[model samples]
Target: MKPAIHPAYRPVVFRDKAGDFAFLTRSTMTSDRTTEWEDGRTYPVIDVEISCASHPFYTGTARVLDAAGRVERFEQRYGRDGGRR
Candidate 1:
């Protein structure tokens, strides 16, 4: 690998706003915002709307869509016999 050609990987904090969760990790991404971490050191902070902590799939709180009801309504409106002679 060549020097000065790759982005620097440094410690940063990712915060999930909805879940109020945060973690420290190394990433190439840059941010203007900073926050003091648990280690008493300042690091770049990135705010996210959703993360594994708040995701419906991971939390097992997904909502099921009513597909059967929609299909039944469509069939009723279009006619059951297809209007064929």
Candidate 2:
């Protein structure tokens, strides 16, 4: 709200090399490197290791652990045989 107290807001590009994905968003972050966008304007670029494109959940490659099944197996093996309730 104060003059010169807020960081400069600018359009920046986030690149996910692993997933070959890139997106543009406004941020206070800056980069020494820049690239010309589709509109022919150069903007600061930020490299990200993980994004929606590369994330397991977003990519539909998440792992499901069977913890409940494991617990049942443990109870059958130990809890019923001289084990406390």
Candidate 3:
């Protein structure tokens, strides 16, 4: 641990607006924005596009790719024997 050479590690808030979720945690990242947490304290807030709360895997809303449909479409485009003769 060096003196004053390392970035400050402090409590910050990560917010997922789409999911309406936020959590307090320590981070070295900084933000000009601030928000009042549930504990009645203000902390730097970082807005994220996706988090566990809104992620497909975590929420179990992942889309299953239609591989069979894709194969059918490809065959239709190129013929059954891959457009050879």
Candidate 4:
């Protein structure tokens, strides 16, 4: 609500190169890099390592951890009594 004290919020682009995905949204973040969006206008672009498009959870490609197997291995190594003896 202050005048000129807050960072400027403007249209920017978030790019996920690995997923070949990009989106335009309003953000206070700035960048020297720019890209031409679908609207033929240029906007500051930010490169992100991961996004919903490429995230395992969002893509339903997440690997289920074998917790039972790990527990079995640990028991085998230390015994059921945790090797207290």
Candidate 5:
């Protein structure tokens, strides 16, 4: 718990450039950019390429692998296509 040893933890805005989304949060990151928030206060703004707002996983736009189809294809090739053992 040494003073002045830690980076500044302050409120900053993270803007997702692709998704056009922005949010305010506290972090130790610094930025040379500043923007006026909805609260009429100027804070350091960091532009990110992707965020939860735009990420495929978080946005539920990710393409799910067809494991079941592959398994069925394998079973058919192995002579186990729903036949009784």
Candidate 6:
């Protein structure tokens, strides 16, 4: 409703250094870094450490430990591994 009060919601390019992935989306963030986009227009280029592209959880690269096995081992020492009843 207010003029110039809201941030610029334009397409932005987010680059991941390690994963070598670049995603384009609309964002209100501003940056000084510029790069040539697919449309042949140069825009601000922002570098990010992690995103859904590089994150372990999103990529299913996260290691899942066996906590249940560890709990059973601990119960065996406490003499409660025979049954749960």
TM-score of each: 0.73, 0.79, 0.74, 0.77, 0.77, 0.72
> Model 3: per-residue lDDT, tens digit, 19-68?
98999999999999999999999999999999999999899999999999
* lDDT-best of 1 and 4: 4
Supply the TM-score for candidate 5: 0.77
Each model's lDDT comes to 0.93, 0.90, 0.96, 0.96, 0.94, 0.87
Q: 1-85, model 2: which lDDT tens digit per residue?
A: 8899899998999999789888999999989999888888888999989999999999999999999999889988888564965
Give me the displacement of residue 50 in model 1, in angstroms.
0.6
What are the clash counts of all predictions, listed in order? 0, 0, 0, 0, 0, 0
Candidate 2: which stretches are off by over 4 Å? 70-85
Model 5: per-residue lDDT, tens digit, 6-40? 99899999999999899999999999989999999
Q: Rank the candidates by lDDT, best first.
A: 3, 4, 5, 1, 2, 6
* Candidate 4 C-alpha lDDT tens digits along 1-85: 9798999999999999779899999999999999999999999999999999999999999999999999999999989999788
Please give the distance, in angstroms, between residue 70's alpha carbon in candidate 5 and its true position after superposition.
Answer: 4.8
For candidate 3, the per-residue lDDT at 57 reads: 89
lDDT of 6 by residue, 37-63 (tens): 888988788999998888999999999
lDDT of 1 by residue, 1-85 (tens): 9999999999989999999799999999899999999889999999989999999999999999999999888779887766654
Better of 3 and 4 by TM-score: 4
Q: What's model 3's overall lDDT?
A: 0.96
